[model samples]
Target: MPAVAPTLPDDLREDPRYYLRHFQFVLDWVAAHHDSLLAESEWKFIVGFGELPEVSQALLVRMVSRKGELFRLSRLDYAEIGDSDRALVPLVEAGMVIRDPLIGLDELFAQLRVPELRQCFAERLAAHGIAKSATRQRLLDVIQEYEEAGDAEPQRRRLSHWWTETTDQLVQLTVMPVCDRLRLMFFGNLHQTWSDFVLAELGLVRYQQVDLGELSHAFQCRGDVDLYLALHDLRGRLDEGESIEALLTEIPPPAQDNPWLAERRARLLYRLGQQAQRDGDIPLALHCYGLAGPGEARIRRLRLLERQGEYAEAHRLALEAQASPCGEAEQQGLERLLPRLARKLELPRPELPPTRQPRARVLELPADHLVICGSVELAVRDAISHSDRPAWYVENGLITGLFGLLCWEVVFAPLPGAFFHPFQHGPADLRRDDFVARRRRLFDTALARLDDGSYRDVILDHRQRCAGLANPFVHWELLEPELLSLALDCIPAMDLRCMFQRLLLDPAVNRSGLPDLVQFLPGERPSYRLIEVKAPGDRLQDNQRRWLDWLGRHHISVEVWHVEWRHD
Candidate 1:
C-alpha cells in the first residue's frame, strides 16, 4: 500500500493539494528570479538535492526542520518503513549522511553520570518520596521509563554529510525547484497566501521556541548547563544594566578540569576581557587574559600592552609569537603590530639586498596553447603531470609540504601568548618594514632546518598532528613523500627551503599567487624551474608579483608562460 500522508488539521485538510500547488508556485517564482532568490551556494545545494530519490529528499527536509544534524534512529517516524536504516542507506551511499555505528544506551546516559546531574536527578526522585539511599535506583528506573516513552516519538538523523551530491550538474538543476520551495517555506515572509497556510500545515517552519527541558541533561551535565546559562546572563547584564564588578561575580571558575570545561571557562573569561577592555579596564582585561586560553587571550594581552604604550614589551611578545602563530589571522595581526611597536621603540630593521631581475629568462608558451577549464595554471599542471618528464603541479603544495616535513618542530611550536580567536579581522595597521625584520627568524629557522636531515621526520610526524586541525598548511596527500623527496633531492636545500620560508613567513602577502607548476630535470645536478602560466586576458596578481620578485632576488630559476588559445 502507498504510505499515507499524515492527516492535516482542519485548515489544510479542506484541500490537500493546496500545499503542493503553493510549493509549485513558489518554485515558479524562484525559477523566474533565481538570481535574487538564492545565493550561489544555496542554489547549488538545492539543485543537487532535487536529483535524489523522493525518500532521500524528504529525509533531508525533515532533518533540516528539526534544526540539528544528529538524529536518533529509534525516534524516527518514517512513513515508508518501521526501520529507517535501509531507507537511509541510499543517503549514506550518496554521501549525504555519515552512518556511524549505532549509539548504545550507556553513552546516552554519560552526562547524567556526572555528580551534579546525578545528584539533581536523585534529589528529584527523592522529592517524590523515594529514600535517599535508593535515589540512584529510583532515578534510573524513572529514566528507563522516560526512554521507553521517548523512543516512540521520531528517529533523528546525523548532519555531518559534506554535500558530495552537488558534483553532478544535471542533478543540481533538477533539484532547484525543491530547494526553492524549502527556502520559501523556511525563511520567507508569509502573508495571507496558500503557501503560508500549507507551510504551517506541513510544520516546515517553526515559530515556537525549542528547549529540551529535562532531556537537556542527556546532552550536557549540570555544570556545563549552569555555565551556559551564566554566560548568556552575563551577555545580557553587560549590555543592559549591570556594573562590571557585578557582572564579574556571576562568572564562575571551571568546575571540572576537562578540555571542554577549560574551553568554556576560557571563552567566558575572553568575553569578560573584551568587555573590560572596551570599558577601559586594562588591568581587568589583562587579568582575564591571564586565566584564558593561550590562543586569543595572548593576542588580546599583546594588544593591551601596545595600547598602554609599552612598545618594547609588545615588540618582544610580537616577535616571539610571530615564529609559530596560533592561526593565519593571529599571525597577520602580529605582523601588522610588530612594525609599529618597533618604530616606536627605534628597533633596527633587517637589511635586504636590492630586488634583482631573474637570471633565467621568462619561458613563453606557444601562441596556440589551449586553455582548459578557464585556468591556464590547471592546464599547465595537467600537461606537466601527464608528460614523461619528472614533474608535478607542486605550486604552493610543494614548498608548504616540505616546510611542514622539515620545520615541524618550529611550525607547531607553542608561541608564547599565541591563541586562536575566530572571526578576527586582519590588522588595519600593516607596515612593510616591521614585517621585513620580524620575519627574519622564521626564514632563518626554516633555512637551518633544511640543513639538518632530522626535520624530515618532523614533517612526517606533523601529518598526524595536523589532521585534527581546521586548516593545515600542507596537504600531505597531494605531495607524497617519494615525490617530495625527489623534489628536495633535485633542488638545493637552502634555496628550496628559503623559497618555502618566504611563502610561510609573510603568508598574508606571499603565500598564494605562487608559480603554476614546478618541473625537475633529470641529471647529475638535478635542476628545477618554477613556471607561472597565464592564459589570454589573465594577469599576475600583486601577491604573485611579490613572490616572483622575492624568487628573482634569491636567484631561483623562475619563468612566466603566456598561453594563447588555439582554434582547431
Candidate 2:
C-alpha cells in the first residue's frame, strides 16, 4: 500500500538487464491499469510503461516533455515471456497479441483491446504531436550495424558507452520526438538490446502485419502531416548531399586539383556565363565563358544565344565552339532548355492568370462542412480533416489531431500541404491531455493488426481502393473518391495560388454530383463525427452555393454534426 519509489541500477547506463527488467515493469503496469487505462480521458497522457523505479518516473517525465518516442518504442526482447527463445519467441508471442500488416484503420482498431498480459509494448502515441522521424531510422540503422557486426566488443553490452552513441544519434538528429532526454538516459528500454520494442518501433515486426504493397496507399495517403514530414525528410537527404559537397569544397578531395575536376569546373563556369547572357547580363555572361578553355560551358553559351533572338551572335559562337571540348552532363544541357528558348522566339510571353478572385469568403452548410469559392483556409482545414484524422479535438484537449476523434471516416483525404498551424498555437481543448491520450490508446488498440505477418493483403487492398485526395506531393489527406463510404459531397477550394496553369485542373463536378465532406455518413453512421470547418467568418459566394446545393442533397440522410473554426 505504500507509494512505489522507483530506482535504477548505477551501472544500468551500460547494462541491458536493466532495460530487460524495465520493459517487464511497463508491460505489467498496462496490464493492471486495465480499467483506468481503458477508461482514460481524452486530454491527459498517462505514463506507467516500465517497472524500474527510475524508469517508471523517467517515462512519466519523458512523455510529458518532448522526447516521447523513446517511451513508446523502447522495449526489451520480451525475456519476460519466459525468455526461452529470447529473440524469435517473443516475436512469435507479440505477433499473437497484435496482428500483421498493422497500418490500416481496421487492423489498428481491431488490435485495440489485446489482452494486457499478451500486450508486450506500445508507446501510446499522442495525436497532438508527431511520432519519431527519419533520424530514428538512421540511428536504428547504426545500432543494428554495430550489433550485427563480427568484432563484438564483449564489454559493449555491459557498459553504457554504446547506448550513449545511439542516444547521441537521436539527439544529433533532433528526432527525439516530444519527450525528455535525461529521463531516456536513466529509465526505459531504449538503453537495452534489440527486443520486441525495437522491432515494433522500427516498423520491422510491426510492419510484418502490413504488406509493403498494402501500405503503398496509406504511406501515400496517411495524411498531410506524414507527407510534410516526408518532404522535409527528403529535402534533408538532399541537403545532406549538399553538405557533403560543401565539405568537399573545404577539404578538396585528395585528388588534389585533378585535371578531370578542373575541366568539369571550367565547363560549369561557362554554363553560368551563358545563363547570365540570356538574362540580358551580357557582359557578365561573356566573362563567365571567357576563361572557359573549350569546356562544355562555352559550347552551350553559343547555343543559348541562338535560341534567344540573338541568332547572329549565336551563329558566331557556334563557330567558335567548332573546336571546343564538351563534357558529359553539360553536352546535352543546351538541348534541354532549348524548347523554352524556341517558345519565346515564336511568341510574346504568355499572359499570366489574373490575381483577382470572383469572391472573398467561404460557405458553411448545415452539416459542418465548408464550401469555399474563394478562401484558401477553408480548403486547407477541410483537407486536413479528411486526410489524417477523421476528426480532431474540440473539447478533450491537445491529444487530438485537428478535428479530434469525432470523425466518421470511411476514406483518406489528404491536406493540400503537410504542415498545419500547430494546434498548440490554436486552442487548449485540443492540447495534449489525458482524454486524447486515452483515445489514441483506444484507437491504437482497436486498430491493431490481427496477424503476426499478414498485413500485406489488408493494406494493399485498402490502398488500391483509397481514393483519398492528395496531390503531386502526397500529404496524408483523402482526395475525392479515396473513400467508398465517406462520399464527401463538397467543392474543391479555389485554386488561390494559380500554380496550375489551369486552376480548375480537375473538371468541375455537376451540381448533382458535388461532394460534401459529410454526405456519406452511413445510415447517418460513423461511430464518431466532426463538423466541417472553414476559415473564420468567410462570406459565401455563388460557386460555393452551387457546391452546397450538391452537398445538401445528402445532408439530411448522413445525420453528421458540426463545429467550424474561422480566424475572424
Candidate 3:
C-alpha cells in the first residue's frame, strides 16, 4: 500500500506559526511509516511531544531549526510564541529541554558578549592583573590560565553562575539528536534542513512530487540508520580537526548489504586518506586508500606506493588498474603513471595506447574584443558566428538540459531509497553505480522515443509541463524556448541517444567536460557543431580531451579554437 502523503495547508503564509505545523507533519509522517525503525526512547518522545502545549511545540521546533543546541532565553524572543519563558516551562517539565546545564569555558565565551564577560569577571580579571578592557580572547586566555594554575575545579558553570545579575537562563534542547535522526530519515541526508520547508512554502524553490510506497524508506534496517549517524558524527569530527588516527579507528566497517552505505563509507575513507597524505603520514594514507572502495582510491594508493619507492607493488597495481579502470580520470592517470613506474623499476617500458588530439585552430583577436564580450569564449563565439549559423556559449547546459527533459519520468521514477522526500532536486541514487541498471527498462523505453519520431514532441511537452522545476541535469535558466526548439530541430535524435548513453555510463563524470559553445546551422536539414574555446596558454583538460576524442569517433563535428590577443 502507498503511504498517505502529508496534506499541507493551502496557504502557509496565512499562518504565522507554519513552522510548528510543518514539524508536526514530519513527526506524524515518520510515526505512521517508520514506527518500526524508531527506538523505544524516540517513540516515547514522539508520543509525549504530541501531548505538549502548542507554544511548547513551537519553541522546541524553533530550537531544533536554529544553529546551536544551547540558546539564551533573551536571544529566543519570538513574537509568534507570546512569551518564551512560558513556552520553555512546559518544555523543561517534559524533559525535552535542559535548564541551567553545566557549560564549558569555550561555550561560555561564545554565549556572552565582551561587555557581559567583563561585567561577570571584573574581580577575577583585576586579581589576575589583567586590564578590564582586554579583548575577549585575551580575557578568556588569562582566566583559563588562572583556573588551570589554581586548584579550583575546571571552570564549568551554569548561566546563572556566569552572570548573576541577569535572570536570563540558558536551555539546551535534549531532543536535538533524536530530531536529527528523524530529519535524516526524512531527507536521507543531513545537509537539507528545516529551511527547505519554509522555502517551499514561500514558493522560492520547487520540487517534483513522487508517490512514496509503504516500503519507500531511506534506511532498510536499524543498522543502516546507526551506521549513517556514525558516519555523520565521524565527518563532523573530521571537519573539527579531530585526530585522523582516532577517526580512522572510529569509522564503521563497510556494510556488505547496502551499496549506498558502503559508498559513503568509501568516500569518508578516501577523504581521511587525503588528509593523512597532506599531513605527511604516508603509511596511514596507504592504509586508508588500500581499504577504500573502487574509485580514485586505488589510483591514489598506486601513486603513494610509487612515491614511497615501492615500484614493484605500484607496477602490479598499475597493471591491474590498466586492465579495468574505475573511470576515465583514473584511466588517464594510469596512462601517465605506467611508463614512469616501468622506468623506475628498470623494466620494459609499457607502450601506452595512442591518444586522439583535438583538431585546433588559432585566432588573434583584438584585446578589446574580450573586454566587449566579457569572456574569451563569448568573444570567440561572436567572432565565428554567422547569419546562417548562430552560436551560444552553452558548455554543458544544452545537451544535459535536453537529456533531462527527454528522460524526466525515468529520472524521477518512485524507486526504493530514491524519492523518500518531497524537497529532493533529483533521485538520491542518480549518480550511483546501479542508477541506470535499476531502471534499465524505464531508460530503454524513454530512449526508444529517439528511434521513432516521437522524441521532439515528448521533449517539448516535458519542457512545457516541468518548466522551472528543480532538476540536477537541467539548467532551466539556459533552456530558452527558441534555443530549445532550435536544438530539437537541428540535433539528430541518434546523436542525443549516443550522448545520453554515455551519460548513463557514468553520470558523475560524463555530465561535465562538454564543449564551451554550440553553433547551429539551421536549414531544411538542420545541423549543429560543438565548439571548445581556449585562451592563450590555456589547454584542454583531460576530461575535455576525452569528450573530444569520443565525439570524433562518433562522427560528431567538434573543434578546439585557441584565442590569442593581437599585438597590432
Q: Give the number of the best model, judged by TM-score.
A: 3
TM-score of each: 0.36, 0.21, 0.94
Ranking by lDDT: 3, 1, 2
Q: Rate the local accuracy (lDDT) of all candidates.
A: 0.54, 0.30, 0.88
Q: How do the residues 1-568 of candidate 2 rate in per-residue lDDT, one tens digit apiece?
A: 1134223233343443444444444333332322221223210122322222443333222323332222212332232232212322222232211212212222222222233201211222222132333233333344344445645542222112222222211111122331212122112212322243344333333211111121121111213222233333433443444332222223222123233234434544554565556567766666667555554555555655654567556544544443342432232333333344446456343333222222223444333233452333344335445443443322111111111111112111122111111110111112112213323443333233322322233333444442232212112243223342232212111111111111112211111122123322233333323233334444433333333333333232211223344443
Q: Model 2, which residues run further than 4 Å from truth?
A: 1-205, 210-485, 488-568
Name the candidate, 1 or 2, with the larger TM-score value. Answer: 1
Specify the poorest-scoring 10-residue window by lDDT in model 1: 420-429
Scored against the true structure, residue 12 in model 2 reaches a CA lDDT of: 42
In lDDT terms, how accurate is model 2?
Answer: 0.30
Candidates 2 and 3, the one with greater TM-score: 3
Lowest lDDT block of 10, candidate 3: 1-10
lDDT of 1 by residue, 1-568 (tens): 1132123334545552344433433433343333343446555554555566655655555554443345555444566433455556666766666554333333333323344334545545555565556544555677566556779743322111111221211011123333434343322211123444455555543222122122111112335444544565576677775666677776777766334445556777788788888888888888887677566787888888988888888788778887787654465466567767777888776333345544433334443444333456666666565333566776767776666556543443323211111111111111122332444576466567567855565566655554323223456557676676667567787686667767555554455777778887757867788888766667776557667778888788888876665455
